[model samples]
Target: MTLQQRVNELVRACFAGIWIESHEHTDAIAELAGMCRDEQWRLVTWDIERGLRGPSGSPSEHDAGDPLAAVRAISSLADGETPAIVVLQNFHRFMQSAEIVQALAHAIHDGKQRRGFVVVLSPVVQLPVELEKLFVTVEHALPDRQQLLEVAAGIATEDDEMPEDAQLDAVLDAAAGLTRYEAEGAFSLSLVRDGVLAPSTIWELKTQAVQKSGLLSIHRGAETFDSLGGLDALKAFTRRAMMNRRSDGQAVRPRGVMLLSPPGCGKSEFCKCLGNEVGRPVLTLDVGSLMGSLVGQSEERTRQALQTVDAMAPCVLMIDEVEKAFAGSASGGVNDSGVSSRMMGTFLTWLNDHASDVFVVCTANDVQRLPPEFSRAERFDGVFFVDLPGREQKDAIWALYRQRYDIDLSETCPADDQWTGAEIKSCCRLAALLDVPLTQAATNVVPVAVTSAESIDRLRQWADGRCLSADTPGFFRKEVNSGKRRRRVTTKPSVN
Candidate 1:
């Protein structure tokens, strides 16, 4: 349910303490305060020093510093025959007190008989076991597109003319993922910087908003589809999936795609390039950076990061090599004391239920290492197995590297060496610096296929019929042709 509906329901259900978990503290308080006023509930305020304040903004004759006084104030509202909402600001600190605990429990039971309610407002969440069962928790979301637009419109006094549909969308898109107050600050900043609303100014403000989180950053890297060579099937699939929503006018599909294959096969690069093709910024999520010392803190951090990505919807969220983040946790071992499992669970839930336009692009090196549930159908649009770069793919890779490093590839011809695209690029780069031809640069280099030939062959054998080949039919067909030729040659010699 939406935050407002949830609060209304909680109040109607006679819930005494409502714990709102959110980063948009000011906006939440303002919205809840307004909601209380609309519901005709008498409003009361509280803090550590000030126990409670009445609707008149009048200080109590009591010292206003005791927890018991706050409970008594709630009781006083019931005696006056008026429904009351007691907003306890920063009262979470006093929750550990035994007397306060019993008092709150007693107040909740007592308030249900009358028009009295308790609202706990705290910047941080610190619920003890005893209060967990008593309080109802809800998350106060940051400002969405409509809300941001309203804020922007409110500040535009001089140029009352509304922004064009496309420009307005762009402005809202940039303003997304920011809280109401933050969006207001950004809107004001934009007006002051440019004297009018502009898309560029919104972007500058968005950068600030993302920087404030430090969990997720708004990336501006431009990687075009043309930059990637070969893998036409994968490219076509990506293009189709991205445009599916626009063409059919349907709600975008749930889940994203997982690109799995050997290392250095352009999985990460393909993910990066998709953002450019789709005309959306890319945000990279580094899972390792989320771990924390406190219990549940890591999960909270992950939620915050994903929330940021959701705020910046209609963008690519790239989790490069996610296997490193969640591997072998299914065994339920205590290596990290189940932190990995909790982290994985949090991510999986988001992947399944996330309805936003955030397109997740997760790349993994070893499918064996990845949790099986992650590769299941519907979780991702498709699971592409990127095999070793064939000879044709290698040629295209070489051309790209040659252009990248200004190398004269005409002098160095590619052969049947098992060099991946990344290795080939590295060879070319080294060749340029050493003043040697690209062929010589590869003399000391060994690719994964060579060092781990058995494993590569096993992967290839497993994928032979099950997975789609990235290379053209001509290359794979050659193996069949050669086998046929060998059978014919042996049979003919026996007949003769």
Candidate 2:
């Protein structure tokens, strides 16, 4: 339901205090006013600039922008039996004052009998401890595709200024997760520059919006599955999953995968490329950035960030190095007073229950640090383990990077045993950068397999028969060749 509908029900049921979380105050207030007008209820608004506004649209400066006075006057604004609503704009700013908190608490408690409703409208919810029990939060969601189309119609006056069917769908897709105000600005800007409502212009603005929030960073690069080699099973699985997804949600959608691989493997690269492959934007979420200094701030930031992720639906959400992100959750709140645990709980709940078309891609180098419940069934479509590249996969990876670095085809590669795709790319890049032979460049590069062999072996042993294979369809199996040497990689033409 919309914000107005939700608020309408709560007010009629005599919910004394309501909190509206919104970024666009003007639009929210307009909707509330319209609802109140239709219901024949008294509506009053207050802000720092405009102390008080009654149903008559006149400002009451008697309170002189004092929040305590404004809250106290809410009951007086109501008729004998008519429900009166006082929307204090940005009321979270004054929550720190003990006097304001007390006044709000008493006002909300007494409002139960007097039919007085106090609503706090702000971008964030920061309820003081005393008033927390009395208030219920209602989020003002961003516009959906249909509403966004109406917005595009308002901006694109000329028929030529609007795009055709498929192009219009792209435009609506780009406008998702944006507020009505932001959508208008983006649509107008797109018309001015491209002469039509285009997705590219709106995408650029959306990227800026994501960056400004400091929650997630969006990647809309040209990289696709063609850029890398190996992980045939993974690539095919994701592509098929995308194809099978029904936009109407009639069928079970792809829940995404948990990628467990050693460092320098292609886990992160595969996630970045999946976006371009499926025509979705990849949103990289850094959990460390969600931490806050104040109490309950981290959890709130986590929820807000995930909400933003959900709003930008039909997209990929990648959480890199996730094992370290929620490490504190594993220790049962022994670290940092359970902040990390709470944050992880919020994320886990969202992961298991969110209905958005978000294909989550979480990469982990160490599975030991992750909570066991995280990898449980239904949370992810599958847990796929990416091991070191085999002979054929290595050949394909080497060929792609060699072409990228402009290396000669006849040149032979140095002995490469247990090398990851990233290591091979690094060797090729170093060979081009140093103007040396591939063999000589290989001398300067040390593979993670050699550096962390013990840990990598243990990880492989644990994943054997437990996780799905990225290169094959069945469960992953260890080669069991500890007594023998791995095959040395040489310059060979790849079949793929």
Enumerate residue pairs that collide in model 1.
51-64
Tens digits of per-residue lDDT for model 1, 1-496: 5677788888887787788776565566666667777887767777766466665557754445676677666766664355677877777778878888878877777787876787777756777777778787777777778778788888887664447689778888877887777777877877788777777777787887777766666677666877888777678877777876664577565356777667888888887888888778788888887888988788888988898888888788889888888874666637888988889989998898888888888887656666678767667776666766766777787788789889865675545466788888778888888988867887756788788777766665554444444443211211224643521111111233
lDDT for each candidate structure: 0.73, 0.89
lDDT of 2 at 264: 85
Identify the leading candidate in terms of TM-score.
2
Candidate 2: where is the Cα deviation over 4 Å?
55-57, 61-63, 245-250, 482-496
State residue 3's C-alpha deviation in candidate 2, in Å.
0.9
Best by lDDT: 2
Model 1, global lDDT: 0.73
Candidate 2 C-alpha lDDT tens digits along 1-496: 9988999999988999999999999889999999999999888899987799876669864464778889878767765498989999999999999998998888888899889999999999999889889999999988888889898888999969988888888898888888899899999999889999989999999899888988899999899998878898889988998767577766677889999999988999999899999999999998999999999999999998998888889899999999999999999878699999999999999999999999999999989898899999999998998999888999999999999999998999999988899889999999999999999999988999989999998898888777888887777877664456643222222357
